[model samples]
Target chain A: MSDAMVLDGARAEGLATVREVPAPGLIALKGDLGAPALADAVRAVTGCAVPGLRRIEAAGAARAGWMAPDELLLVAPREAVPGALSTLEARLAAAHHLAADVSDMRAVFRLEGQGAREVLAKLAPVDLAPGAFEPGELRRTRLAQVPAAFWMEQGGFTLVCFRSVARYAFDLLAGAAAPGGEVGHFA
Target chain B: MLLLTCPHCGIDADETELSPGGEAHLTRHGPGATDEDVEAYLFLRDNPRGVHLERWRHANGCGKWFVAARCTVTLEVFGTYPAQTARPPQHVLDAIEAKRPGATRKLPVMEGAR
Candidate 1:
């Protein structure tokens, strides 16, 4: 199967990809088990071996880790996309813990440049100032009541939503993009 | 601006997730526990400082009932444990064990506990 799926609509075209690296902007790993083990699994997958911060400790320069107890999302380059999930689940399995693959549950996207933040403001309640969210900060919220994951960096903004809500959020976001600004996609 | 640690959902949920049962500890003066105990259970509170454990529903996501640890002072949350679990945290266990009449630990007793 193709590594990525493209979803086209009236206003926006969503590039749905099976990311290996958890996407540069936001990555989430959801589990049905306990938080600590799920968080540990995230650490194992992201290749950042740290200690003490259990279940959901922020890791990496961009602050990728478990945002919710049931899931962990990592923020990394688009190129790291393919192997990210397996590496995470495998490490957790070795520890005698179970980690469910939910990468498909969410759709990843990159919204950057000067116009991206303006587009996000229309949809999110939190301010998206570069200084405000920085790189590592992660937030769980609803984009039109659809569960979403978000992170900010110098490039602009990256967000992920459950596949079920991807199309809806994409239109909302794409519609909100600046008058002349373009929405770009990379998997 | 209070942060509630939901044991079941495993996140620092917004105050919206809780309905503010008002206070924590309660009196149980019935056949062994009374109406004054019942009245006090029905209404009244101490509103103590430090670590407070209270009942909260995961209204948005899980819809499961759970206990939460809340700090009255800083409004910061530590963590949460499942409500029906065989063993709750030692502190919560201690609070229920140390019940004294008219002690006034907190308010909004669990309706189901009656």
Candidate 2:
């Protein structure tokens, strides 16, 4: 058998730029948000404070965002993930929390350029308005019928959906981004 | 689509993010309880036409279970509260009373109950 591929080697086609961010480290941290030790362990690992509700905190190469009151998503460079998870686990061993590497379980896509937000708006039910979802904010919601997460980054958006339906997400984004799609207009 | 605010996350969760959990504050009737009591707990529901209390889960958001006081007819949401309490919070009751005067339905208080 051939080596497994991402997005099944499919490419995004549209006005908005859509491409997979290959192999980013995704670690899910879950615990009681009120625990100071959990916060400290997260800070020690990520070099940034654990973000508050619906917020993202980035320090140098590490980025951590709140997924829920008791859950957080930590992202780092692909190469740094293993060491970072080990350090985090060792530090947070005494605390009541769970840390798991979920890099391979999710597919990350970068949707950028002028029509990126519009493309997302077509699928997601949440408000994509600038004021509602500003930079560094994260939303765990449905993209069409699939569960996904969205966050604003680098003047664009980063979308993460389960790897099982990644091709479907890519197809939806590409179709929405195609020219003459009539998005953001009342028909 | 009903927009319910999650008391835990404070987000106005759209109906898609929320899952409706039937009636709220049901008295459990388990072993040693009378068959009538068990039947009431299992099958009986107020199904009131107006003011009602409901259980809802912020399934797609914070994943916390909460109680919502809403109008069955108009779909007007009075408020949401945490699910840990045995009864509706005072403020939630007050809001319902204020909105629909004399319309609040009280749960039957058992004699010698805590």
Candidate 3:
């Protein structure tokens, strides 16, 4: 019931401030690219357009992030997920598509500070140069042996990973953020 | 440290983010297949030291399967393409041919209908 379920008892004045946040209502949509039916279903449920490639699009109170060429992650208020899933499923029934609720299967984290990008750079192999990787871009890569996806929020980066690996993810983030471990890649 | 580009996601993915799916362009031998046919299909892979076409999935990034042509010896990736293709595209083949001339391993032609 606590937001720190995954990142419990973690404290340090590190490069970035890492904390576990409540997971958002997540619906994973998988279908053919450029499929109108699937797009309509997603837009109808999230009030947001399906993001292009690895971009994240925020609209109203909901948003969608591109997970893959054929997959999109819809983020919305947790309370609206059940009804949203039903609507999405009903609309996508005629198409060769898959729409499933992944809210409970995942965990969320936030990393703030100038070291945020550096925090992820240490864990992932992808380029985290502030210039190459700007806000609004979503990246899915291996985070210290676990798969994670991160996108920029207002203040910092918001990360999502499997709930089972939430504790490990938090530790990885915290360890990367530990003081004196800075690489200053973003500078 | 091998950076492989995922044709689907258009990102050069790290080898750690990928799962090797073994040899690429395999013709499956289903029911009524001989023991050799099954063995060749499943176990028998073209282990060429030079140009090798292999299957790789961007497991951590895009999660889409793709085919990669790289040298097993040099570890130089010739190119990568979407996994849906029945065989390596012309560009990938040309790249392999350009590097290791005549090193491309052509799938052995079966005598009859598989």
Candidate 4:
């Protein structure tokens, strides 16, 4: 298999990657995981303590935890992604946990900068703030009504959604972030 | 855009994840309580105050009903707890069994009913 791949989209610019992916702000990590290994995997990705993955705010990363018993998502920095997954899988395997390559099955995206919060508000109704969502904090919510996993980092937000709805979510975010759009109204 | 601090779901949920459940830790004045007590507990504090503790529901999220501590004085909510944990407190499983004898409904029936 090729190391990288890309899927073309309705918009000519489309998307490109060394690995086949869903869309922007989408990340997926699937494995033959149970709760413990999944927690270790998440810690590997976010570098945060995981005890039942409680709902508490993090110092720097906006994190939202979603687990399907074994499968999980650590939506954070794309830059930290490669190392994150490798480290996570390594940790899980070392502990004798089952894992699989879900990178192709999941899509990841990065949304950040000054207008990042505004962009998020258009899709989610939560008030994104330091107190509400400190860095490292994670939440599983809907993006434009689509179920998604979200994480907040230094100046941006990252998310992973179902592959099928990746395009719909992308279109919604793109439209929301467009100049003179609803998100623009908030700005 | 209010940040409802849920004890179970933690913070960081959109308003859509929760529904306003009115004030927090409120109690009835009881039978034959003073008129002043009733009024104060009933309709006296609708006005926003600083540091108010209110009740909220994690409707679409964890499905756990809990109390939210807010600052009506400041309009800031910083914490939450399970619904039965509010003030008056509901009887526990043991207490219910002892008092109502067969009060516990079957899980499947309750689930379907809800």
The best candidate in terms of TM-score: 3
Per-model root-mean-square deviation over C-alphas: 9.7, 2.9, 2.6, 13.4
Q: For candidate 3, write residues B31-107 as lDDT tens digits.
A: 99999999889887767766777899999998899988888888999999998987677888778789887665553
Per-model TM values vs. the true structure: 0.51, 0.89, 0.93, 0.46
Worst 10 residues of 3 chain A by lDDT: A3-12
Q: Which sections of candidate 2 miss by over 4 Å?
A: A1-5, A184-187, B107-114
Q: List chain A TM-scores, every candidate, in order.
A: 0.61, 0.90, 0.93, 0.56
Off by over 4 Å in 3: A3-12, B105-114
**Which CAPRI category fits model 2?**
medium
Tell how far residue B78 is off in model 4, in angstroms: 16
lDDT of 4 by residue, B1-114 (tens): 676655665656667777787765566687799999898778865434333345677654544567654445445444455776634223433333454454334211123333
Chain A superposition TM-score, candidate 1: 0.61
lDDT, model 1, position A147: 58
Candidate 1, residue B45: lDDT: 55
By DockQ, the better pick of 1 and 2 is 2
lDDT of 3 at A119: 89
lDDT of 2 by residue, A137-176 (tens): 8888787778888888788898888889888888888888
What TM-score does chain B alone reach in each candidate, compared with the true chain B?
0.57, 0.90, 0.87, 0.53
Task: Record all residue pairs in model 3 with backbone atoms less than 3 Å apart, i.e. clashing.
Answer: none
**Predicted chain B of candidate 1, TM-score versus the true chain B:** 0.57
Tell me the spans in candidate 1 whose CA falls farther than 4 Å from its real position.
A1-3, A6-44, A49-64, A74-90, A94-96, A178-187, B1-114
lDDT per residue (tens digit) for residues A1-187 in model 3: 5542455534444898998877878989888758888778878888777789899989877989999988899999889999998998898888888878888899888899888888889999888886788788999998989999998888789889999998889889999999989776677
